[model samples]
Target: MLHVSDIHAYYGQSHVLQGVSLDVGKGEVVSLLGRNGSGKTTTLLTIMGYLSPAPGAITWDGQQIGGLPPYRISRMGLGFVPQERGIFPSLTVLENLTVAARRGLRGEWTLDRVLDLFPRLRERAANRGSQLSGGEQQMLSIGRALLLNPSLLILDEPSEGLAPLIVQEIIAILHEVRAGGLPILIVEQNIRAAFAVASRHYILSKGRVCFTGTTDELRDNEAALHQHLGV
Candidate 1:
């Protein structure tokens, strides 16, 4: 569903993504794994059009979208959940979902569907974003993205800063979403969570793809894990 090939990006002349290439097929869950400053987040930002790639192609469903604006890319069926969990602090849960809602191609993700996915969100429908716990806020973030009805979901660090149980819950939610056939590209620091939900993995080192394989392949290659991911 998404392809990024030989993409190079820079932040004011400091090169970030150097010839990074990866693909997420339809209904596939892929994880981009790397240590801090390895350009995993930068790759997502480039794909979302927040950072433009000067020399390569980013294609969605076979059309190039290298320099398109973020909103335009989003309207083309890509939903992004940043690490910061950009929910409006003053908006109630329902209001937040309603504001970003967009009819998807399949028309499968309705407000009720999202609420069903996260029952705690239904319980706190009236609560302001700031009033929820970190895990609840993370759930709201994913829920809000689902309201967009995106063909592909891009999540950055969905399991970061949460308790183990909450991380497990998030992993389960991702598995459910994957079962519904929504493709995902996740940038994750939590290796366990990433491995749990991702069928395929890409490890980046110094702004380049150093390894790409299935979960079992990664499991057997501890050297790659330690060298590129420091795991």
Candidate 2:
């Protein structure tokens, strides 16, 4: 459902993403894996238009989206949950979600369904974003993204800064979303979380793709895991 080809991006002459290419098919979950500074998040930012690619193309459902603004990309059915869990500190959980709601787009993800996916959010409906625990904030972030009813969901480091149990919870929730046939492209340093949800994997090294394979293939390739992912 999404394709990125030969993307090269930079931050004021410091190249961050070089020749990075990847794709996520309909109803499939793919992951970008690597150690810190491997350009995983750079790939995501470029795809989401937070950073523009110098020489590459990003396409969604066969339409080129390279250099499009983030709002435009999001309106076209791309949902993103950043590593920072971008939530409004003063807004109540419900408000944070309702503000992002896009009705009648995909029509499958609603506030009710998202609450069902994350029951904790229901209990914290009146809580402000800054008042929640780290896990609750993450849940709020994911729920807010789902309320957009995106055709493609991209999460950067969903498991970061959470407890092990919370990570498992997030992974289970992601599995449910995938079961409903939403395509996902996740960037994760947590190999275990990535393996739990994604069927395909791409390992990056020094701003370039060094490995691309199925889950089992990556599992069997000890060198790639050790070298690129530091697993």
Candidate 3:
């Protein structure tokens, strides 16, 4: 349901995403993978309108949205969970999720639904964001995004800097979300986590797509895994 074609983006005068292209189809989970500086997050930032892409096009469900503002894109049913897990440090866990909640046409994602998905959030409902662990904060971030009831979810580094068990939990939650019919475009440094949930994977190098294939194909190609992903 999302398509990005040869998008180029820059930070100041330095080009960060050059000719990057990929897609996330309906009900499908797609992973964007690469080593650091390979433009994975840059591609996402560009797609979400934090950075504008020049000389390329981005269409969601067939409408061009390359240069729209972040809020506009978000209101168009695109939910973003940034790499930093952008939660309000002073706000309570319940407040963090409730503030971003929006009732979609179907209202499939609700605060109770989200809390059910991450039960720990319900337990910490009264705790401030800064009082939570890294894993809890990550859960809060994902929950807040879900409360938007987006058509497509784009998550950057969802499994970053967490315990192994927490990573596994997050991966399981992603699978559950995929099963619930939301298409996802995920950028992950954790190869195992990406493989666990995404059907198709794209590896980037120097802001370009270096490889695109199914999970099975990626797993079988040790060379691509080593050369592009350092796996």
**Model 2 Cα lDDT, one tens digit per residue, 85-172:** 9999899999998887843255778889888888999999999999999999988888888888899999999999999999999999
- Clash pairs, candidate 3, are 1-25
lDDT for model 1, on a 0 to 1 scale?
0.92
Model 3 lDDT tens row, 1-231? 898999999888898888988988889999999999889888989999998889899999899999999999988999999999999999999989888884332478988999999999999999999999999999999998889889999999999999999999999999899998999999998999999989999999888898999999999999999999898
Q: TM-score of model 1 relative to the true fold?
A: 0.97
State each candidate's clash count. 0, 0, 1
CA deviation > 4 Å runs, candidate 3: 102-106
Q: What lDDT is obtained when candidate 2 is compared to the true structure?
A: 0.90
Residue 202 of model 3, lDDT score: 98
- As a whole number from 0 to 100, the lDDT of residue 19 in candidate 3 is 94
Model 1, position 26: C-alpha lDDT score: 85
Runs in model 1 with CA error above 4 Å? 102-106
